[model samples]
Target: MTDEATQRLQDAEEHKKSYDGIMGAATEVGVPGALGLTMMFTSLVMANGVLLSILAGVAVYVLSHIIVKMFFSHH
Candidate 1:
C-alpha cells in the first residue's frame, strides 16, 4: 500500500512536469505568433501611408522581440 502510494505520487509528478514543459513551449511560440498577427491586422486596418506602415512594422518587430526575450529558453 505504501509502495503503491509512492509510485502514484511519482507518476503524478512526472505528468505534471511534462505538462509544464509542453505549456512552456506552447506559450513561447503561441504568444509571439498571436501578438504578431494582432499587430499586423491592426496595422493593415489603420495604416494608410508608407510612414504609418513603416512605423507599424517597427512596432510589431519590437513587441515580438521583447516577448521572445522574456520567453526564451536557456536549456
Candidate 2:
C-alpha cells in the first residue's frame, strides 16, 4: 500500500511537469497581442484620453511584435 501511494505521487509529479512543458511551448509559439491590446484599449477608454490612448496603443503593438519575434526566433 505504501509503495503504491509513492508511485501515485511520482506519477502525479511527472504529469504536472509534462503539462507545464506543453504550456511553455504553446506560450512561446502563440499570438502575441490580443490580451495586451484589450487591456490597453480598456484602460484608454476608461481614462478617456485621446492622444495618450493613441500613443499607448501604438506602443503596445510595437512592443508585442518585438517580444514575440524575440521569443519565436530561437524556435
Candidate 3:
C-alpha cells in the first residue's frame, strides 16, 4: 500500500481508539458525577429548610434519571 494510504488507516484507528476511551470514561465516571453535582447544586441553591432541600434534591435526582433513561435508552 502507498505511504499515504497507510497513514490514513493509522489515523483512523487512533481516532477510533480515542473515541472509545472517551466514551468508556464518560460512562464510568461522568454520569454519576454529574448527577451528584446537580443534586448538590439544587439543594444548596434552594436555601430552604434542610428537610425541604433534601426532598428537592431527591426529586431532582429521580426526575433527571427518568429523563436521561427515556432520552438515551439503548435499544
lDDT of each candidate versus the true structure: 0.72, 0.70, 0.71
Candidate 3, superposed: residue stretches over 4 Å from native: 46-75
Which model is ahead, 1 or 2, in terms of lDDT? Answer: 1
Best by TM-score: 1
Q: Give the alpha carbon lDDT tens digit for every residue of 1-75 in model 2.
A: 999999999999999999878866555433435645665687687895867776676677677767866865774
Error of 1 at 36 (Å): 0.6
- Residue 31, candidate 3: how far off, in angstroms? 2.2
**Which runs in model 2 stand beyond 4 Å of their true positions?**
1-36
The sequence of per-residue lDDT tens digits that candidate 3 reaches over residues 1-75 is 699999999999999999978876665456645775677677778777677766666676666666655665673
Superior by TM-score: candidate 1 or candidate 2:
1
Worst 10 residues of 3 by lDDT: 24-33
Q: Per-residue alpha-carbon lDDT of model 1 for 1-75, expressed as tens digits?
A: 999999999999999999988877666656666666666667768756656755676677677767676756554
Pairs with steric clashes in candidate 2: none
> lDDT score, residue 71, model 1?
58
Better of 1 and 3 by lDDT: 1
Candidate 1: C-alpha RMSD to true structure equals 4.1
